[model samples]
Each structure stands twice: as structure tokens, then as C-alpha cells.
Target: MSATIVRRSAIMTAAVAASALFLASCSSGGSSDPSDSATGSDSASAPTGVTLVMWHQSADADPQLNLYKAYEAASGNTIELVDLPADTYTTAVQTKWATGDRPDILEYVPTPQDMRQLNMSENMLDLSDLAFVGNRVNDAGELDGAVYGAVLGPLSSFGMFYNKDVLDAAGVDVPTSYGDLMTSCDAVTASGADMVNIGGGSEFPVNMFAGFAYMADYNEGDQWGQGVADGSIKVNDPEGPIVASLTTMKDLVDAGCVNSDAATATFQDSIAAVYDGSSALTILPSDFISLFYEAGGGDTATVDETIGFGPISAEKGIGSYSASPIGSYFVPSTGDATKEAAAKDFIDWITTEGYQDYVDEAQAVPTLTNATTPDLGGLYASLADVLMDPSTTPAFNQSVPGFGSFGQVSVSVLVGQASPQEAADTWQAYVDQAIEAQQ
Candidate 1:
């Protein structure tokens, strides 16, 4: 299945009820730059000599650990950083919360459902009124007009990662729009290489198509997203965005831009196909630059020399947009006042002048205007420009509920089990059912 589908399962797994636990503990981790003075309320104080516990998934090697250690030494309050394993972090956090043991600070992705479950507006400390709030690009952590979380560092964009060597060898330019993509695909294919490795067995292609479709209708997504949330929008509607998106998917497939083994290939298989020089492109998030490198199991320098990322819109003239996650941080109100204040101060420090360092460490686009990112050459540089654009929107699937079903519907369309319209309608039915159940 697609990473979206898999991640959704990861969200709901253990049980729908158990998902409550997962949401309660969801967040992101980051590294910090200590040279710049932290900016925020100086009055926000921690209990002297107290060891504040923080639950996060940031690796030990991240510079944030050192920064926190510095905070501990300077303030005389110990920050006991708990590095939760990726697979069990959600469960562990939820279990701790269930047992009435909550961390002082939480690093998570603040999805709508999770926000509701946590009663975020009421329970999480309101960061909206803080001076640090001014550094944010948008209120991604806002729920019902109250900002409950701090989005750590930067935004990660989704796009196609190309094997630069292969594209160069085939005389293919990096695709900037859908038309360019098709032309590039044709050129690459004519050169006897797979145009792109589509992990059709997974929801990956659907993910890319969703990015394209979402960019096409981005300005209207919030309205339709609310409609979906309230049962007014259905995927199967004749003129719905869902149907339009599915049609785009079909067109890409019919154009013969996809690999022949797409219907059977897994994500890892697609990644390997590109690494071995059999394919030119694979749609993925920017962070996957490292993942692709690690997957290759080679020296980092060699991988950096081979791969790059670029944008692809649904049409010829429009600039491409990709969905990005605003990694969120929260200070739970369940803790004591001293702990809460310290957590707030820690988070506030993260948004200050040196925030760019954390973002660079994460290989993401900085959320702060003053922050700088490393110069990633080639297609990745192009994608970074798109990300820096003020008009860009978050990915649609991430914004709308019930969007995960598109992956399965996409698979059906690929296998001839359903037409694009049929797939759209099926997804609509699923959305309708979900809406009714919520009612």
C-alpha cells in the first residue's frame, strides 16, 4: 500500500479506540543552534533542580540534544530526554498518558482528529499569544482559532526525485509541469529506461497524483475539506475534485509514463529500480534524499551526487505545490505550572533566530522567514524555491479526512477493476459512510 495508507493504518491501529492514545502522543523532534540567544518571555521559569521529562523521537545524534544539555546546564534544570522508538513511540506516549504520567513537552504531528481527542483548544497551552508565534509562516497548529501547538523548524515538501545521471544520459530536462513530465517521460522511455518507477501496488502513484490534483484545486480545498468534514462533499460527485484527480491519474497511466511492473512493484523495489539506473523518477518527500541514500547503502557523498528533486503541477502554466507536514510541538497542561512554563520556554527558544539550524538538520524548508537552508543543487533546489513561495498550500490528503481511500481506489483503476469515475464514486461512498458514522 501507499505510505499514506500505511501511515493511516499506523494511526488507527491497535484499534480505533487505541488510536486515541496515538493521537494524544503524536509530534516531531528537532535539533537546535545554541549560539543565538533564545527569544521569548524571560519570566517563564522552571522549578530549580527539577528534571523535566520530554518525550520525542529525535535521534541522539541531532544537535538539539546538545542544545537541551546546554539548557540544562545554564538553567540548572535537567531535561531528561526520552528517545522513543519510531514504531512504539505512539503507543508508549499514549500508555503514559493513560497512566496519568504526561511529559512536560511533546513533539508530534497535530492532525485534526488527534487535536479533537486531546481537547487541544482547552488543554494544550495557547501559543498564539506568545511573541514566538510571529516567527511562524502559518497557523498550521491552530485548531478552532486557538493555536495549541508549535510547528517545529520547517516544512517538508513532496515531489519527484530523479536519478540525475540517468536523466542527463537520456537528455531529459527535469519536469516542471505535467506537460514537461510527460515529454521527459517519453524521452527517457525512448532511451530504453523506465520513465519512472510507479509503486502502483502501493498508494505512491496515487499520492503523486493527489499532490498534482491538490495543487490544481488548492485554494478551494479548505472549503471542500470542511464540506467533506460536514458531509456536503462526496468523492463520487460528477464534478468533484476527487473525480478530477482520478482522471489525472488515469491520463498519466494511459500515456505509458508508468513502468510496466508498477502494478506489482513495492516502494523498496521502486527505490532499488531507480538506484540501479533502470528508472529515472520516483515521487517522494524531500527528506527521502537521505532515505534514498541509506536505501542504497553507499557513501552519502555518492548518493548526493546522483539524485535530485523537482516539482510537477497538474497543468502546463501553474507552479507546482506539494503537501507538507508542519512538525508540531505541544506543552501539555496536565503537568505542573513550573513544568508547563519550562516547556513553553523551550519551545519558544526553538522558534528564534537560530531555528534554521534545526531545519537544516532535518533537511526541510525553514518555517521562519529569517532562517536559511543548505543549498541543495539541481531539482531539489527548484523544489526548495517552490516551497519558499507564499502561495503554496499543504497537501490535500493531509488536510482532508477520508482521503486515504483514494489509494485503494487508485489501485483498482490501475488493475481494470474500476474506472476512474467508478473509483471516485467508491471513494465518495466511503467518505459518505464515514461522515454518517461520525454523525
Candidate 2:
């Protein structure tokens, strides 16, 4: 999930036209920079007054909220913040759109399905004019050649989070390959502990593994993805790489490499195992480094030294990783032009140097080129090298569709309700169906 820029070629002509229409309908008409003196000045000094409404679903909202307030104060505009609960944000937004009462600006992750559903090319603001969203060498949120949203910052790479104390006590080297991991599982379990704590109740992790497998076995620029997109690849295609990946995951469970209670555990519970020293590893994002340190009741310094990270190792060749933008702000097709302008201003300000500085200070990565590194107690710095080269190790979870189903598959495989082959088959089936629906 490391945020590396990716270059995609132009889409078909039909896609381009559709995108153009979508952009036109959603156009809010304003400069991409919110902090421009002309846009931020008081009404007495500026051309007109504007009001904006924004919706966001991140767990950490205070920093953004305060930042928004400052933007409003400085720009002399009225800005309203709508904080949606994480679980319901998707449904809520859909409902708003269905009711024809969309927010002026909203945050969304632009998955392929999302692109198809929103027809975003014709229904969202064209952010290509913005420096942060447009200037990146690889623009991730673009769909069908029309950029919909701006990424918040660099992508966070996902990998196995291990407890050094547990691994050391078990005499297992940090695993560098799938074979090594399988061998380490035996020693970990012989120590009377679970090798990995998995949250089977959730679906995201299982889907992540499926995606990772696809990336690990194939080159990033290959036709596997296009095949999936165009209905040429079957989820249960007998000869597909998905089956092998699922088999590996199944092998892990069959060999007692993961917690037996994984099927019923919630995400928090699984993560708690690592913090409490009951398990050796948990697949998660780099941001979790901060959370783990805080949860262990240790200061940043202690956590930085104690935690270690590396890419997911492969048996032979390198592995590719997947990542998505932190959700982005999108202006709707039906908002008032003035409000839309205001909304765009807010987006511009948030991605600017002033806001990125705040993000850096908060220890979060910034998307802008001039972004300053946050003082994250050296946790991020420790893993910086690994994060940058994730694709060279194990595949990331982003390359797959239906990423939400990861946990369910993990649970099924762990509990023996499904064999590795069966799980892989089911996952591929689901992904194939999803891809078809989008098409």
C-alpha cells in the first residue's frame, strides 16, 4: 500500500467522452487554489460571498475540522462540516445522491466500481486543474481519464506487523519468504502461541491477501488486471493464479499458522493479540505503527525501537503491492455554483503547504511534493525504506476487487469451513462478479 505514483495509458474513446460529460456536469468553476489572495479575501475586498458544505468519514476528524475552520476564518466564507460515521458513509452518500440532495463537497475512494456507479467523469469536479491532484507523475484517483478526487497524501503500505519479543522467544527469524513463514509457524505454535492473529469477522483482510497474491505472481503492467476488468478472467478459472494464493492461505491455517479463534475475532481483538504479546504478526498499514505504540502504553521512543517492519517476502521474484488514496473530496453535480466554488477552495487549502505542514507536524505523511516529514518518533522513518519498496517484496491488497471480503475468507480458511482451494475459488468468483457488474 505504499504510495508510489503509477502511470496508466489513455482509456478508450467512449470512456473519454463519458468522462468529459461527467466533468462538465460536475464543474464548480473556480481556481484550484483555495488560498489564492483573491479567493480568500473578505467579501468587501473580493468579488462575491460563498458558503460551502463538506462531508468527511475519516476516524481522525479534529485536525481536518480545525483546518477547515481556519480556512473559513481566513477566507471570510461560511463552511459547514458533516462528519459521517465510517461504517455508514457509503450508504449515506448513496442515499443523498438518490434523494437529489448531495453535499457540496464529499470525500470518496475511487474504486473501479465507484467510477461506474457515479459516472464521475460527468458528475464530479475535474480536479486535474489542481496542483496536488493533477501534478503528481502518477494520478491514482483518475478513472477513464478524468480525475475525480485528490489523494490526501502518500499511500500507506500494508504488510505483516510482528512482535519482536514473541518471534525472538520462539527462535524464528523474521520471515522473508512464504516458505520461511510456513516454517516459522511451526516454531511459533510449538511455543504454545498463535503465529498470526487474524480477524476473520472482517472481509477487508482476506480480500487484501487475494490481491496480494495476484500482484506477487504477475508483473504490475501485465494483462491480468485488464483481463479481470474485461471479463476475460474467471474468478474460479481453473488455471488462474488466484487458486494458488488461496491454497497458500489455506495452508497457513491448516498448519496452525494463525489463531484458531480467528473466525470469530473482530479486527480490534486480532490487533490486541499482538499488543498483548499473544501473537507474532498481524497484516496491517504503516499508520498502525503509531496506534500500536500508543496502545502498548509506551511513549513514541519506546515503540519506535521495539517495532520492526519489512516488505512481505517472496519465494523467488519480487512481489507487487497495492495502495489507495486516503479518501478524497469531490464536489457533486447538483451543488450551487457559489457553494461549489467555496468547496473547491477548501480542498485547495487542505492540500497546500500550510495544511501539509500541519499534517507533517501531526506525524502523518503529506501528498504534496514539498511535504515535510512529521516527527513520528522515528516509527515511520524506521520503515521508510521498506514502505518505498513494498512492490519488491510481497503484493499489496489494493490490486484486487471486493477488498472488503478479506476477513471472511480468512475466517473460513482458519476454521476449516472452507479449504484453501474453495476459499480462493469463492474469492475469485466474487471478484469476477464485481468486475462484471462494474463493466
Candidate 3:
């Protein structure tokens, strides 16, 4: 897939609330009860055949469509696939849901409040009984002990992926600390290359900086989420590490470390810049290594020998790299038992060991603990140590409040529109606002 499509898919998973609101009428009522609600239970009275209408963003449509076909062929059920452009996915889902036209199975990104706000917790089938989904739903995707969604893909880590050739050509070792990373920018630039290529126009890339910084500084497992929940941690707190990270980014810009055009570059363009040798490294998702191979014309053998992956910084004792589960699938609470059963069955089949193998073969990673990592060609084969390191954690972008806006603020820092300090402060304010709004 193109970088733009990848980014859009990630955004769709993260910002389900924003898009849901625009696409459908908000339902205000008590949250649906998974134990006793009509939307929650399976029908015992009759054998009813159901057509499960499913919706997913374009980036996911291809794989999911194939999976659904497998599901139908195996189970003898009809599944209607609705593939919408990633840009329009949220709007379309909301519109369909608002008009009282609901899909039996829906795949979208979810925030904590989405279930209650959209009444999906009440309207979609609850999959708590399914072994695969029942195992993965934490507080992040659940509310009040009920799960509304199932994580569908492999967990992903976010960090700097370097073109080994570029780094080697510049005589710079892969950085092990933030200080080294900042210092190496000049050496990279001196070699007629930019140090990093980030797509600031997209929110997720910017959010990654905050997530990485938080992981770097905080040791408490899930402390970032706790801070947001308790109003103790703010995204922009001048006293916090995220601000320092932002400042460092600003310092790089001042030093001409990143591409001058980075602030406005689309994700695809930025990836292209790295591929064509205009830049040395880029902050990328774990799947990027595989994407890199594809972009180089699917010559895995040729690509495997050249790429490397590492944590977001070289700052030892600070933090390890982290990843979050993005673009998961969820079954909404619906009033029909037959439909609910079918939904759960479909989810179970997809996340099963057999299907996970297919996913690993197709997508390079499987989210389930039972699945094996696919052969990621050569560019990423070298970074296996970094990607699977026990020390790595999930990035806060998937969990932190108000982190979605980090990209815009980072862009401002890069373009001199906002001082790093101001950007940090703004982020904290956003966190505070989000906490209050959620409460």
C-alpha cells in the first residue's frame, strides 16, 4: 500500500470518535449491558441465516475482503463487503449507522468514549465470549468490563527506520541516544542528505514524538494513561519529558537536520524521499520495512540487506521503543441474537490460528500471540532484534488523551509558528481538556 493509504488507515483506527460523530447521529442513553442486553446475547430459539454487512477503510479492504470470503465459504453465510476510501470511511460509517442502517460487523478505530457516545456498546454484538478477542480487550478498548472490539492485526512499534546505506555513507553509527541523534543531523546533512523524513501533515506522525518522549522518560507501565486519566500528566507540561522531546525536534529544525519540505510533505512523498536517497531515516511503523521492500519493486532479496530499525532515540536508561495495536475490528451490540452469534463466529474465524497464518503471509505480522511473524524480506530482517525486543512497549498515541494533535503542534515547531515550549504547553492544555471532557 502507499504511505498515504497506510497513514489514513492508521488515522481511521485512532480517530473513530471524530469520524463517527460526523457520519451518524449521536445516541444518548445508558450504556448497553453485555450480560443481559438484546444486543449482547445469542438466539436460542431458531436457526436464522444472516447477512453480515461489513465496512472497512480501503487500506484494509483487500485483506479483509479475502478473509471474509474465506469466512463465507467455510461457514456458508453471506457477507457483504463495503469498501470506502480511508478519507471517507468514518463519515460513511457514521452516516450508515445514523440512518438506522447498521452493519453486522464493523471495523474502525475506537477511543474510550466511542462506545458510550455512539451507543455502540448497546447496539453491536458483544464478543466477550470469543477466546481471541476476550483475551486482548483491555481498558483501552473497553468500558465497564465489556469489550466492544477485537484487535485484528499485529501490534506495531513506531521509531526511526534508517536507510543503512545513507547512514553508512555519512559515517554515522545508528544513534543510541537523543543527544547523538541530534548531533548526527549535521553530519548527515554534511553528507548531502537530510537526517529524517517525517510527515507532519498527518496527526499520527506528530503524535509519535510525544509517545516516544513519554516512553523515554516514564518508567511506570501505563503511567501516561494513568496521568491522563487522573489529570496529573499533561501533554504540554514544561516539566515533562514530551516537551523536552519537542524542543529537541525544534533544535533539529534550527540546525537544518530534517528536510526543509518536511512540514508539508505527504507520507508517500516523505517515504519516496528516503527511498531515493534524499534523506537517511524516517519515523515509520514496523510494517514500513515490508512496505520498503514493496516500494523497491518487491525484490525482497535485494531490500533485506540494506535496512535497519531501532528505538526512537539513543537515550539509554530513558525509554525503549513502543507500539500500539492500530486498525482493530469490533462487533457492535445489536438487538438480534442470531446476528450476534454470527458476528462472534466471524471474528473468531478471522483471528484463529489458520487465518493468522494467512495474515502473516499477507501483512507481515499477526496480532495474535499464536501467530508467527512473516518473513519481512531483507531491509527489515536486520532489525528483528529491535522489533521484538522484550523491552519495547506500546506507544501512547493509542492510549493518551489529546495526543492526536501532536503532529500539528510539531509542524508549528518545525515552521517556527510555535516555540517548542509553547507547543508543549499547548499539548498539556489539550490533555487537560480531554481529561475533563472524558470525565
Candidate 4:
């Protein structure tokens, strides 16, 4: 077998960690009174033979998809899976809701705007008290003290990923502070290689800003979205912490430490650059490490041994890193009791014992500490440690509502289309629009 196929097969086997056992029922079929109003027990009153229309974007090979089929077969309930296109899925879902043809369950990125767009607070079944909520590592979709969403994949963090062999060859010690990082970048470049493989073609520049801002938040001990909530600060202050954070990325650009083809390189391309030893470092979320391994044709051991993960920092030197939610599933309160109960049952089942299998199959970080970790090894394992830290805070984009504009504005600054101040002003407008949308 080809090495790539071997690795792909390994990934698939890992994701299918264990065969899933169909739960007792997808419906609340017991004789319990139907209108009990208790969250967990509602399943007992769900009717059998009810078809749940699940609208989602999970891949055909996703382990959860198989589990969906298992639940259907075991409980005699039906799951009408409507797979949607990724780029237009959210808009399509909104259309369905507007036209009164929404699905019972929804799959989305779980961003604040996405949640609000679905009328989450008003329409989703609250999973706050589910057994799995207690095992969660972070508070993501919790709003007004209610858990409205469940993750379909593992939680992950964004930070700096470095190639130890490359850095060592350049005699650059792992950077401890933002200034040290700049110095290291210069040294790595001077060694005749790219210092950081920042793929600027898409929203990576936004990720760059976010990485620095996350470090700043850790250094200053201020939560990223707290200012918006308490009215103490605005995200768009030209001189604010967020915009100020971009100065580091801009300096890197000026210093020629960023890959010259960054403007056109995709994130996977950058990962490949690092894997090929053409670059010493890159900024990305921990989840993308799988691609780094894949680019090496499944040479998991060499990839893990050569690369290292560390938190990017300001003066505080690794005060914290940011945790972002991934694979969020929501049970929209479709106002149909049977469907709602079935949705709850399905969500609840996935998050239970079957969750580990899902995590294994997906090769994602388990939100529950008790779940087994996939054998990703090396930098991924190291980054996973940081993600498990109690001091970890939510990423700025995840914490702040309507924060997609931050990425767009950051892109303009990276490309020299806007000054930092101009970008901040533009970001402020987005923030204002976001707030207005919430209202």
C-alpha cells in the first residue's frame, strides 16, 4: 500500500475507535408523562417512528454519521440527513427557518452570530444540564447560563507551531516573548529559510492578529470579550490591545520573515512548507496539525519528533493560550415535541460513551477529560496540554459576537490596503453592526 493510503487508513481506523452500540431508543418511548418539562427525561415521552430531519455538513465518512444510522436502526426512528454545501450552509439554513421548513437538528461553526442567526436562545433545546456538559473543558455555547450547543468535534486552540529541527539548525531557541519571537524570526530567515509560513491568501492574517491578541490578553489578564460585555473598552481603538497586537505581525512582514508567497498560499500549503523543512514556524490552531502529518505522507513519528508547539506570548511569556470550539451541533426547538425529544436524545447519545469513539474517529481533542486521546503525538500532544490548562481563555473571534469583521479588516492591514488604525476603525464598525444585530 502507498504510504499516504496507509496513513489515511490509520486515521480512519482511529476515528472508528470502537463500534457504537445503538442506544435503547432515539424516542422518549416510555410511559412517562409527555409534558414533564424535565430536560433529560423528555426522551421517555418521545414517540416512535418519528423522522428527524437533520441538516448538517459532516462528511460522509464521519463516525457520527454512522452513529446516526445506528440510532435509526436500533430505535426504529428515522434520520433524514440533508447534507448542505459548506460555503452556503448557514444562509441555506436561515432560508429554511424563514420558510418554516427548518431541520430538527443543525450543524454549524457555533460562532456567536451563527448562534444568534438561528435564534439559539429562543429556539434551541437547552443541553446545559446534560451529563456531558459537566465534563466540558470550556464554556463555549453557554449563554445566560444555559448550554445551547454541543460540539460535534473536539475543542482546539490556536498558537505558534515550530519546527524544532529547523529552529535548532538556525541556532534559534524557542521564543519566550513577543520581542524574542521577532528576534527568532530574523535569525531563522538569516539561516536561509522562511521564518513563519503565514498563509495570507484567506483569513490567516486574521488568525495572525488573533494569535498575538490572545497572547496580549494573557499578558494583561483581560478576557478578550470582557470589554464588550462590561463597556470598559472598544475592540476598534486604533491604539487598543487588539490593533496593537497586529504590530508584531506587521513587523514580521516588514522584516521579510513571512513567506513571500504568503499572499497566495493556502493554510495547507503552509503546513506542507513546514513539513518539508522550508520554514521554521507557523501560526495556526492545533487542529490543523493533522494536515502537517498528512503532508508528510503519514510519517507520524518523524513529523511529531521534528515539530514542537508553543504558546505565542507578549512580555508575559506564555501566560495563556486561546481555546476555540469546533464541531458544534444544536437542537433547534422546532416546536414539535417528538422531533425535539428525538433531537435531544440524539445529541445526548453522541456526547455519552459514544463520544470517545467520535473523538477517536475524528482525531480531535476530546472536551471531556475522561475520553481517550488520539495518538497524534509530539506537537499535537504538547498543544493538547496547553488546551487542557485551567487558565485558558476563549479565542477573541469566538468570544466576541460579530467578530468575523476583525479577520476581514486584519486582512486589509496585512495586504497594506489599510493602516492599523484604519483597520481598527473598520473593525469597530463591524463590532457595532454585530451589537446591533444582537439587539
True-vs-predicted CA distance for residue 17, candidate 1, Å? 45
| Top candidate (lDDT) | 4
Per-residue lDDT of 336 in model 4: 84
lDDT of 1 by residue, 190-265 (tens): 8777876777765655566554433533432344556667766665777776666566656667888778887888
Superposition TM-score, candidate 2 onto the true structure: 0.78
**Model 3, span 141-174: residue lDDT tens:** 4555666677655445566667788889999998
Which scores greater on TM-score, model 1 or model 3? 3
Clash totals for all models, in order?
10, 21, 24, 7
lDDT of 4 by residue, 302-382 (tens): 887887777665564442433233356788887788778777777776676356556656655555543555544576557
Q: Give the better candidate number (2 or 3) by TM-score.
A: 2
- Which regions of candidate 2 fall more than 4 Å away from where they truly are? 1-53, 61-66, 69-73, 76-101, 217-219, 313-327, 362-366, 372-377, 390-411
Residue 1 local lDDT, model 2: 34
lDDT of 3: 0.59
Model 3 TM-score, 2 decimals = 0.77
Q: In order, what is each prediction's RMSD in angstroms?
A: 10.2, 8.7, 11.5, 10.2
Show pairs that collide, candidate 1: 2-203, 26-108, 27-107, 27-108, 27-109, 28-107, 28-108, 31-64, 309-379, 323-395
Give the per-residue lDDT of model 2 (tens digit) for 406-438: 446645766778876777677677776666666
